[model samples]
Target: MTAPFIPVNTPLLDGNEADYLAECIRTGWISSEGPFIERFEQAMAATAGRRHGIAVTNGSVALDIAVHALGLDEGSEVIIPTFTIISCAAALVRAGLVPVGVDCDAATWNMTAEGVEAAITPRTRAIMLVHIYGLPVDLDPILALARKHDLKVIEDAAEMHGQTYRGAPCGGFGDVSTFSFYPNKHVTTGEGGMILTDDDALADRLQGYRNLCFQPQQRFVHEELGWNARMTNLQAALGVAQVERLPRTVEIKRRIGRLYDEHLAGLNRIRRPVARTGYADNIYWVYGVVLNDEVPFDAKEAMRRLGEKGIGTRPFFWCMHEQPVLRRMGLMRDESHPNAEYIARRGFYLPSGLALTDDEIARSAAALKEILA
Candidate 1:
């Protein structure tokens, strides 16, 4: 019999997930309103070291809420990493804000403060920073620049849950931060996300935006148009269960990362994820592998071969500046981010999900080496 295929990402749901779901069904509180929603929001706020957490349907929507809540001018520019998900840029664009893409560092695969500094303009309103894969963007210098320029920092900590930078929480730094509880994330809410903030007024606005801007003074009245991106009680129930087991989950991810490091140490054809940086250790959100020039093929070919061996893989995010949509819209028309462009073509991640086993990890690494050889 053929062996099973190890998926690129799978969540570990061995917690109170079933119990929470049972409670939700028994109580008939499965909509956006329920005790679990508040509980999950509060728990996540505490986890992220923020005063308030606004639950939403997904991370992309959370970004949309965050960007609009800032109340930036229509054409204000926000700097973001070029090598990041389209959702990041889309949030700004849809909010009538301009997104300026910056190149990330080759080693950490995270944006540097210097690149952000150079991208700052008089019309720059905020630094919408994202923590890439597992490692965090160097935040201190960026925070300093934000302070100097009196700009807001919108932290996209979707990939940095249970992570910190220089002993501070990843989601706690910026004026506002967002987290995604996708099945692939450390905290899986079965399609949920949150916006975190210490500012009471901002939190209020965020809540309003996520829920159709309902006015508290009157029922079924809306002074402003907003998204109906509220998270269901069922999703929040899962989030509450997952947040309770986060520390254990983080440790599991770290162990998997270390094992991959040991097993693939001598594979010169592929570059491993950065183990640690000056301020923090990589949480290995995904054990990304970059094919060097000697590999003789791009990530697509490598992933195809790995798939044939029943080892799943995923490619890195494409550079936003090179996106056809952005160029077609006449935004960043002729820009290039060299480092991100190079990795976007060659980098891909292995099976690093919480459901992965030791044997699977070893087999995946062995398959990769065999293909390279």
Candidate 2:
């Protein structure tokens, strides 16, 4: 008989998730305001090595809040990776800032400092560095560039919980950093996010933006508009539990990556995810594989075949330059991001969730070997 179908990602909820959630339910503190919300915020801020963490509704809104907190002018430009999710670009656009696109490094599948430097113009107000998949970007050079250019650094370390760059943590380096606690993330809150920063003023601004710009002195009088992107106490309950197990969660993800590495080593037609080097290792956010030129088909075809074999897979992010919405907005027209486009076409990640078992990983690897062969 065939084995049960494996999923792309699943949360590991064997911690204090239930107890804390029950506490919230029992206390009738299910809304955004509660003890767990503050506890989760504090834990996440400490985890990221920041002074303050303002919890938000989701990762996308976290980006929006971070962008707005930068206090850039309406037409200011922010450099971002072309290979990342649309939320990064949309956040800048929604904040009335232009998003300048840069291609990813062919090997690391991350935006390089060189690409970021090359994309800088006078209007460039900040560099929004996204730590893609679980590997932190080479941030020293980017930080240096920002210093020389007087640009703000927004670290979107959503995919890199517990992942470090050099000796320091990923989220600790930037002017402000953002994290997502989505179910697929290492530390999950079902649907929540946080903005981290050491700056006292920026943290205050973030708190204001999270709750519809409610004036402290007067309850409902608002001078500026803000979003109701507050993360609920119930979600924070899960977040608190997840944060307590972050180290173990990261280890499990790395172990999953290693398992796939061992099982898929002989497949010469596909390139496996990068391992740890002088920089941080691929925490294997997902065990992404890139099909070589010798492969007969692209990632879409490979995903279809893997699905047929009861193996779940997800395609890599499409390049922002080719996005229809951006095109309609007269942005990314006739632009070519070769590396981003190539990776988007060839890359896909397998079932690398924290909850995936050794047997599931082996079976998924076996299916890949058969399909690729």
Candidate 3:
């Protein structure tokens, strides 16, 4: 008989998640305003090496809040990876800032400093450095460029919870950084996110944005418009537990990557994700592989075949320039991001969730090799 299907990802909630959640329920502190909420925020900020952490309902809303907190004028340009999730661009657009798209590094699949430099213009007000997948972007040059250009750096470290650059943490470098506690991430809060920053004023603004911009002196009086994106105490309970287990989660991801490397070593029709020499080891956020030109099929076709064998996979993000929503808005009208387009068409990730077992990894790798062969 065939084995049960392995999923693309699954949340690991075996830690203190249940205990903390039960405490929240027993204490009747399940709402947005509760002890767990503050504890989670502080713990998350400390983990990311930031002074403050403002919890929000989800990753997309976290991005929106971070962008608005910058207070950039309408039409100010923010450089972003063309290969990132739509949340990056959408946040900037919603805040009345123009998003300048740049392609990723062919090897790392993360945005290059060269691309950021090439995309910069006088209207450029900031850089949204999205650390794609499990690896942190090459940030030294980007930080130097921002310093030279007086540009604000917003690090979207959603995919890089426990990942680092050099000796520093991913979220620690940005002027204001953000993280998602989505189920697939290293740490999960079910459906939650947090904005991290060292600046006192920016942290204040972030809190205001997440809480409907309530005036401190006058309760229910609003000084400016904001969203009700506050994360509940129940989510915070989960987050606190998840954050405590981040080190182990990262180890599991690396182990899965190594297993894939071992199992898929002889497959010549595909190229595996890169782990740069100087930076942190590629934690393999997902065990993605890119089909070489020698392969007769595209990623979609390869994925279909794998699915037939009961293996789950996910396609890479489509380039922002090719997105129909952005196209309709007249953005990236004539721009072509070759690398981003290539990766989007050719790359797909295997099951690399924290909960994945050795047996699942071996089975998934064998399935991929068979499908490609």
Candidate 4:
């Protein structure tokens, strides 16, 4: 007889999701114009301490909207941590803006304020601050530099939905901030994202950009081209229920992180996620494990062994500087990010999903320990 397989992520959606979807179906309000869309936007905005939320089809498009809303000059440079997903760079690249790469701290795995400061130049117009894994980038010095250098701040709080920085909400920090509701996130709407902001004029632009830039004054007139990146009433229906249960979900994530910490302790050759910092503890969006140099095998070989044990694993994000596409485009031609490279090659996340069971954790840990040992 074989044991059950453990997946990397299984979203916990035991909330009012069904009830809200039923409401949308019963009332025939299933389009983006439905009542649930507005309700979800308002709920997310209020939670993030922002005056407005513009829901989008997905998080990638949300960053697209955030970047374009700022209207940064073409050929302008925006600083970004090289450790983030390709979406962060894609947003800048699509807008004809340059993405200046900076390395993150080896410990927290978040970009350093010092790295970002060094990367700033006369062409610098904005900083795309991404909160990685579960810990946030140190914002005080970075925000201060943004103020002093007059650079726009676009916060990527996709994995930090219920997280805080020095008592302030993650989404509340940037001039324009964004969130993702992918199934893996603390809040899930199946597939969705939100752009949050306090500026009234910027809020209007965000909404317009999300909906093909339709002019209310003349419904068919278009001054500028924009994306049809509208989130469905169905996704928002789930979002309404999911957003309300954020606090409970956050605790669940923290609990999952704690369990992994206990299980993987004493594995000297492996580095665990930082449990806490002065400003915040890891929300443990996913439990990342970094193998030290002494480990006999790389992540690929370890994952192969884990797979044989019916354990699902995922490798960490490949550093942006090392991305072949960027290299071919004449970017990062003469640069190196050792810390980002070190983790990307050697790290992978265990099964840290919301629906993961205690027995599964024990089983997964045993399997990995056997491989590493």
Candidate 5:
């Protein structure tokens, strides 16, 4: 038996991270509104080709701010991929709007432009495009559709830090975008998030939402009822260090992804992920393999078997509209997202973090072959 453990995720921090955190503490501005925060926001904005980037507590809050900044009123609808983190749908719901879950494209596993068109109603106000598992969702068609329909486009780029779609960065393409800087993300700040936008007004509104809607002009003036969702200078310091190192991290991820593609091919039960043509860029946060529906095994069984081999893996996201909490909102009824359902049942992610040693990857791959063969 292979010895006892492979973690599903691990933080990719070691060099200079502790020093940076210490420097932030020495500076005594660890809470908020400090030099590191400004620096991080600016650096991220530049990376995304956006004029503004607002730091927030987490990706969920970033999504909430993005939704609120759009000015969508009650009963307004937001179209989102059903196969995504529940936070994407929950953000829209929290903003007093309706979430219309749409099916994903069979080939790319992202929102299909045709599906978006079919789901849009007169009440539709926006479309939130999620770049799942680091792959760029096909965006040109979706952007064109948004323009034609005059709908706002919000990008959930939490899984795609350096990914590009047709030469444009993932977070740079939408009207507004949100990013998660969780410990496992390509570049992390412990527990932080960012909002990137070309719209100055939206940026300002999001910043306001991050700080309890406190007026910039008056110290304690409240402009709107908002949550205290703020990222600290310590987190920003960590972010600055991580962002500076991201180019190398991205290259490492791509190299690993290609290796997985090459080595895992021809395995009977596994269907490798394919990067769509005309969309070459990706971050490879999680490398996925779809289990064949006819294989007589499901995700749960597959994961359990892998676990017994000391191999760690996780199932894909359950379709958000099918979740119990969202069901009470009446958002999922009369809706069936076949692709999302299929992936949820047959998909699981491998250990693809940048820090995974090559030997570990080979060992894991060997274990997968043993089980599948």
Candidate 6:
């Protein structure tokens, strides 16, 4: 009999999650606003060491609001990594701004200060940093560069809930940070996102935008044009439950990731994920291993072999510079970023869900060893 497939990503749910849903039903305030939503936002803000969090419908909307909250004029350019989800670039475009795609650091698979410095022009308005794969991107250098250029920093902390660098929290490092509570994230709220910041003025602007640009004191009075991107009370109920269990869930993910690290660290054909000197915390959303170029087969074939063993695996995001949408929009070109392209082709993720059992991990490891051998 064939072994059951090990999925690349999965959500771990529990009775606590159900309890939140039941409470929401009992309260009968399942739509736009409720006590659970307020409580969830409060809990999340406390977790991130922030003063406030504005819940949104999804991550893309969170990014969109972050872009607009900065109050940039049309045609201002926002610098973003070429290896990020397309939403990062599209959000800037939606705000009537230009996106300047920068190359990634091969080590972290995230935007480098060098790339940002090289890409900046007089029109540059902000630096949007993405903490890819739950690994905190080195923020000091990026922040310094932003200071020198007088640009703002908006962090996409979607994949990095509770991740830390040198004892500092991920969301607190950026001027304003956004998070996603998609099912596949470290925590789940079915589908939701949040914007957090210590800046009360910025937080207030974001909250206003989230609720159809109406003043909190006056109902049905519009001051600025905004979209309806509010998170439901039902989703917030789930979020509150997940937030309570997040510390344990993150611990499990880290333990499983360390197991992968211990097993794969010494392999000649595999390049394990590297942590810089000061980054102390990571949840390892997906255990990424780069296949050394000297390896006999490329990433695609490696994935195929893993799949044949009943292991579900997939390739990483293709570099945004090479994506057809950005190219068609007349933004990127061939000579833009070779590092992003190389990492895109070489990196692939393995099964790294929090729910994977020790037996399943051992089985997956044995399959990988056999294939790589």
How close is each model in CA RMSD to the real structure? 0.8, 0.9, 0.9, 0.8, 1.4, 1.8
Global fold similarity of model 4 (TM-score): 0.99
For candidate 1, write residues 1-373 as lDDT tens digits: 9999999988999999999999999999999998999999999999988999999999999999899989999999999999999999999999999989999999889999999999999999999999999999988899999999999999999998899898888889889999998889999998989999999999988889898998889958888889999999999999999999999999999999999999999988878899998999999999998999888999999999999999999999999999999988889766788999989999999998999999999999999999999
Q: Which candidate, 5 or 6, would have the higher lDDT against the true structure?
A: 5
Clashing pairs for predicted structure model 1, backbone only: none
TM-score of 2: 0.98
Q: Which ten residues in a row have the lowest lDDT in candidate 5?
A: 274-283
lDDT of each: 0.93, 0.90, 0.90, 0.92, 0.85, 0.84
Which is the leading candidate under lDDT? 1
**Poorly placed runs, candidate 6 (over 4 Å):** 216-218
Q: Which ten residues in a row have the lowest lDDT in candidate 1?
A: 327-336
Clashing pairs in 5: none
For residues 1-373, write the lDDT of model 5, one tens digit per residue.
Answer: 5475877777677657788789888988898977899999998888888899999988988998888888888889999999999999889888889899899866567888889999999999899999888678888888999999999999999988777787777789878998999987987997999999998877778888888898868959886877798999999999988888888888888887788776787686777777555676556788887888667778888888888888889889999878988888677777899999999898998877777877767777887887777
If candidate 5 were superposed on the true structure by all CA atoms, what would the RMSD be?
1.4
Estimate the TM-score of every prediction: 0.99, 0.98, 0.99, 0.99, 0.96, 0.94
How does candidate 2 score on lDDT? Answer: 0.90
Error of 2 at 63 (Å): 0.5
Superposed Cα RMSD, model 6: 1.8
Per-residue accuracy of model 4 over 256-360 as CA lDDT, tens digit each: 888887888878889999999999988999999999999988998899999999999999999988889988887766779999999999999999888998899
lDDT of 6: 0.84
Better structure of 4 and 5 per TM-score: 4
